[model samples]
Target: MSQLANDSRVQVRKKSKERSKFFWGMVYLAPALILMSVFIFYPVLKTIYYSFYYTNNRGIPVTFAGLDNFINLFTSESFLISMRGTFLYVLYTVPLGVVIALFLAVISSEKIRAIGIFRVIFSSTMGVSVAAGSMMFLFLFHPTIGFLNHIIGLVGISPIHWLTDPKWALISIAATSIWMGIGFNYIILLSGLQNIPEDMYEAAKIDGAGYFTRLFKITIPLVSPTLFFVIIVTVIHSFQSFGQIDILTQGGPAESTNLIVYSIYQNAFIHTKYGLASAQAIILFVIILIITIIQFKVGEKKVHYQ
Candidate 1:
């Protein structure tokens, strides 16, 4: 009977200790929770609230504008052009980024010497600032004096106005974006490639699978999770592309390359149409959210975590 009583006391003590530990854990996490609520959650709610109101030259006039701003945005020709440009930007950037990154990852994963040095060389571009990189590309693609045009001259072709010509301006920006982004994606895919088991490749080789077959049938499937992650992130970043457009094109040659985010910036800061800008921002947020959710739904089926 005494032993039974002692065991019950020990159980009670353990339960008390567990409760104490949980209490302390909550205490440790409180600061982070508070910070997130203040910085992230509050800003989101405030932005949504501000989207419904109109602001004038004096200040923000807290009167609801209903769907007027949204209606105006959709009806505007510039908005339409911006939307088209933004879509083109995302479409080209995401797939190209993924494919190039995957290719580089495969090459880097090979049994080659100085792998670390090669890795650094490939990823070095990621460290360059967006504005600086865009400006560099601008000079490199200059019509007559550009290095690229000089090379093309040897091939019996005239200089291309990469940035000044409307048709070529968007393409130029896309190329610069790809060059700047490929390095980061390559590093991500390289990490994923390294995590894949060597034995799997050996097994495939023993089964008479060629390199391309193994890559398509085995490597791709195993790395699908990482690939999906990279795609989603790349898509989001592409949608938010502003620095390149601002520095290189400035929505130039006829606002041909004006993207949605840049348009919002112009409306808000340049035009001082805060309410209109907020509405545009809200629309952008919704579009991104819907697209991201769709991607998650579609990609979840294909991702092979194992």
Candidate 2:
């Protein structure tokens, strides 16, 4: 009877221990879970709800308008322009960022001396905030007092309006975005490059393969997984670009540089058209989701884990 009683006590103790562990685990995760629910999930659902209601003057009425907000978004010209500019921005930024990052990664992975210093210099831009970097680039390309204009003057060329000119404004913004993004992508790609085995390169060299040939055939394929990640992230960032447009151009010069996110901000906060803005935001979200899904679907087929 004593032995049986002891076995029951042991089972009770084991159950109590498990309960304690489970309780502590819940305690540890509670704060993060609550935050996610409050901020992320709640806001998303609230936005969708708000998208169906219209507000008039005096801020009192919020009548349900069903799909009117969505229909308005489809018919809006400003939204269309913003979407076009956003598409162009991403089209340029993603490919440029990936290529430049890969180039920097390859250079940094070389056997040359001072690689650490180069890495630090390249990655330092990542520490700078987007607004600050945009402002700095704005000054650098400023038409009259800008350093770049001075260099052009020395070469007997006229100073080009970097921010004010509609033709060059988006291009300038894209260049700055590429410069700012290169550092982070370089670090990621460099880490991936470091993980590659040196034996593969050695074997390629023994087979009389030159540097460029081996790089094309082996290095690129091996690093494709990292490249795919960089491409997706860069594309997303480009789609969400607003700060550069806000600070550098303010969507001026005929709204040539206004992106979708900036236009949404203008509608919600600036224009006080909450319902319409919410609909626009939902559309943007759906577009991003579709693009990201497509990227993963296509990338998985091309990515080589080995």
Candidate 3:
């Protein structure tokens, strides 16, 4: 009876300690929880609530909309255009930006003379704000007196309408986004490359492996983790591209560059279709979530951690 009582008391004490630890943990987490509740959770819940209802011009929910908002979004020509444009934009930006950045990373990792100068030059675009970069590219893409047009003109070609033409407008925006993103990508990839041990390369050389062989076998596999991170970030960034689109094209030359986020902005703020905008926002969230899940499931298999 005495031993049983002692064991029971010990169990109680353990439970008490656990409860105390849990209480302190909650205390420590209170600020973050409160901020997340107010900022992230509340907004997300509000957006989801708004998505299923019709809203007045003042942004108050007026009536239950059921699936009407999503139905209209799928059927609407403008929304479809925005969807297509966004996907195309993602496709154009993610691959090319990563490739260019990777190439720059590889070259800049070399121990050549004045490589620091080259590194600075290569990664300089990261310092430019999106709006500023867009404005700079705006001048560059101008048909009348642009540097690009001037170069083409010297080569006996007529000046092409870069921003005005529907065919080239998206491409031009993709180019600008790629350039703006390269500095960040380059830095990340360079850091990844620098993390690789030089001894691995030396061993490969001793084993009669050529430069390309070592690069393919050693450099790329080690860098896969960084490359994966860059790809994910770039995809998300491309999907959410807004500043450059707003500054450069305003989703125009007939809504050719009407990305989903900008489309959401247009519907919500500009047109006062709050419910529709909320629905679009939800769709964007779902799309991103699905893509991220898919990437982790499929891509993480190839990520090698050293």
Residue 45, model 1: lDDT of: 83
Best by TM-score: 3
Q: Give the RMSD in angstroms, all C-alphas superposed, for model 2.
A: 3.1
Q: What does candidate 1's lDDT look like per residue over 132-183, in tens digits?
A: 8988998899887899999999999988999999999988889999999988
Query: lDDT by residue for model 3 over 67-121, one digit each (tens)?
Result: 9999999999999999999999999999999999999999899899999999999
Give the per-residue lDDT of model 2 (tens digit) for 154-252: 999999998889888888889989988888998999988988899999999999999999889988899999888888888888888888889888887
The predictions' CA RMSDs to the true structure, in order, are: 2.8, 3.1, 1.3
| Each model's lDDT | 0.89, 0.87, 0.96
Ordered from best to worst TM-score, the candidate numbers read 3, 1, 2
Local error of candidate 1 at residue 91 (angstroms): 0.9
Each candidate structure's TM-score, on Cα atoms with residue i matched to residue i, is: 0.91, 0.90, 0.96
Show the colliding residue pairs in model 2.
Answer: none
lDDT of model 3, residue 160: 94
Give the TM-score comparing model 3 with the true structure, all chains together. 0.96
